[model samples]
Target: EPEALDPRLRAPDLVDRELSVGLPDAATRRALLERLLADVPRAGDVDLGAVAARTPGFVVADLAAVRREAAVSAALRGAGSDPSEQVRQSDLLDAVGSVRPISLSGGGTLGSGGLTLDDVGDMTEVKAALTEAVLWPLRHPDSFARLGVDAPRGVLLYGPPGGGKTFLLRALAGSGDLNVFAVKGAELLDKYVGESERAVRELFRRAGEAAPALIFLDEVDALAPRRGGSTDAGVADRVVAALLTELDGATPLREVVVVGATNRPELIDPAMLRPGRLERLVFVPPPDAAARADILRAAGRDVPLADDVDLDALASELDGYSAADCAALLREAALTAMRESLDAGEVTAAHLATARRAVRASLDPAQVAELEAYARRRSDG
Candidate 1:
């Protein structure tokens, strides 16, 4: 069983001492494959070790299915051939491709979208912090254990909307090989009583099974608002309680981390910001001049540009622009150029200036002040 067994069945009156069987390692998987294919004809090119290396978190049953699929593939390929034509490496690889990992097939999704740290233009400090909070734990677990330190349990990224908080989360998820269970805060709320809490429990359970996984809750304020003053009839409070329990409950979460993003950090329950829950609160401020320049360059990488276009000046002018705002500016610039004439040679400075004038910055002075205050409070705390 991938999940917890019933407590009643574990009583002395019913079951004996329980034994846990974990997923097979590479050597174990190779040996199991050899055992299963002992009677089956396999091609010389077939390498069980390579196949085992590719299939992580695969159980014996999954290996059996792979063999069955491979056999079927071989039969289809070797029609009207000798009885010992054998299953080729290609057949086995195809079978592996067809078989999804149990974690993704059942609960969460795989975190391999080809988005790396490079995809995120700037935010060097934020990227370093995330790496320490997330990647360091998985990469240097021994160092942490030796130092008698517990890795950060959760990271909360708070910033203005369209500041690339979600994009940063996705990049962190894609930086390594891990399972990512992404859920919007609104999606977790249920109309029925207790169902919301149960959903939170199950989400954590799935994340545990897929250890080294990331549980990303976008717009976290929706799920965990300040308690006792909500208009939702205590639904958010219950969900927050459930979330707190899961974050620092009796059962330790090994190789699992929770990441949350919100535009309103002030609205989040203070309990969630405690040491054991979302210990690391990072303020994702709007992109600076260099970041804006990078965003503009990236957005205009393929678009034809005229000699009059000055990215540096444009970046300086768009001081408080978020990443999304920079993208929109570029898009608006292209549209402006297109509107000027059907044969407008390339995007020009005039077009970019018009776009810049049209699209206002999203973050106002008050919101910026609030974000700054929150950052100071976090540091003081």
Candidate 2:
């Protein structure tokens, strides 16, 4: 489960009151908890609440399970139900508590919509460029650096929204045995001034220890928002500081790769763009014909379609659709077919035409013209 965004996610230094302990046998549970606490608690730490406060890494889920089982037991007793079935002795969860170790400050997963770089069918030049600039170096960090030394520390994958940049990042790291630390900026902030900073320090420290790691930070704007002239001083600032230190610091984890993704790269701190920081920046644009066809095949190869579903014409019409958009359109068509099948009879050629007619190109004609003009303008430059 995700870390609770509320105050529950942050543990306080002290406990507020004595809460009732619920277990199969209170005597054994209390005894075990006291034993664990007694090993670490200072003098005058006599209360159960105090003991709990002292306990680190005590999972709330386990405690909830105990309380739930106890409630079930009580209800069964009132109903004269079978004690064994109501709440078995094994229902009590173990209360083994230990200090939770810290981890990296900024790492999080991109959306796992299965849109890999492979799923992106077109833009061979874009794909090749990204590979040579980012993946090739990552594969042979020392050789690419040409110094028999460390590789690029971090890579920033930034592009337009719905461009499948994040999807590419996930495809690059979803598997293949890389230790990934994913942090969501929206979820990592703490009101306590240094809590987020501490977490950040711990996160990088852990990543170094677990080298050959991938740190993926999504929606980095929350941490590295454009440092304006007059922004409020808060925990966000500390998180930003911690982020810089981790990214730029001379860590021994030579194989560690940091990947930060955002739709609005302009909103990020300018300093991060420097080489050896987020030295590599790859821009993922919308799909071309090859990519659109691949995305459609990947999305709807399994779905039964009529012979009249013109893949070429569909691809031509979907000039500006990203891999994500292509998949969405395919799903929309499939859903329409499913509904039509249930509502009437089998889906036919006319149904596919109906679906295609209903589905509109995401980009306006003006935007397409502008993009073409911009690409050409850059060529002139």
Give me the displacement of residue 220 in model 2, in angstroms. Answer: 2.1
lDDT of 2: 0.57
Write the residue-wise lDDT of candidate 2 on 1-381 in tens digits.
123335553446444343433212223435554454343312232344433332222334444433455445445554655433333222222121112212221234333343345554455655565556546554676676677655667777665566665555666654333445677666677446677887777677656554456677776766676555325565666677678887877455545677787766666777776776776766555667866776677666566766677777777677666666776777777677777666543345566556766666674556545545544553465
lDDT for each residue of candidate 1 in 1-381, tens digit (9 for 90 to 100): 524678788789888676766666668889999999999888789998888866655778888999999999888777787655789998998897677666567644534465666667777778788888887886678999999989889899988888888887777666544557888889889658888998899888777755667889889999999999888889999999999999995467878888899999988999998997998988888888988888788767767989988898889888778889998888898899889888877998888889988988887768888888889987996
User: Measured by TM-score, how close is model 1 to the native structure?
Assistant: 0.77
Model 2, which residues run further than 4 Å from truth? 1-120, 123-130, 133-138, 141-149, 229-232, 342-349, 356-360, 363-381
Instruction: Please give the range of 10 consecutive residues that has the lowest summed lDDT in model 1.
Output: 103-112
- Local distance difference test, each candidate: 0.82, 0.57
- Count of backbone collisions within predicted model 2: 12
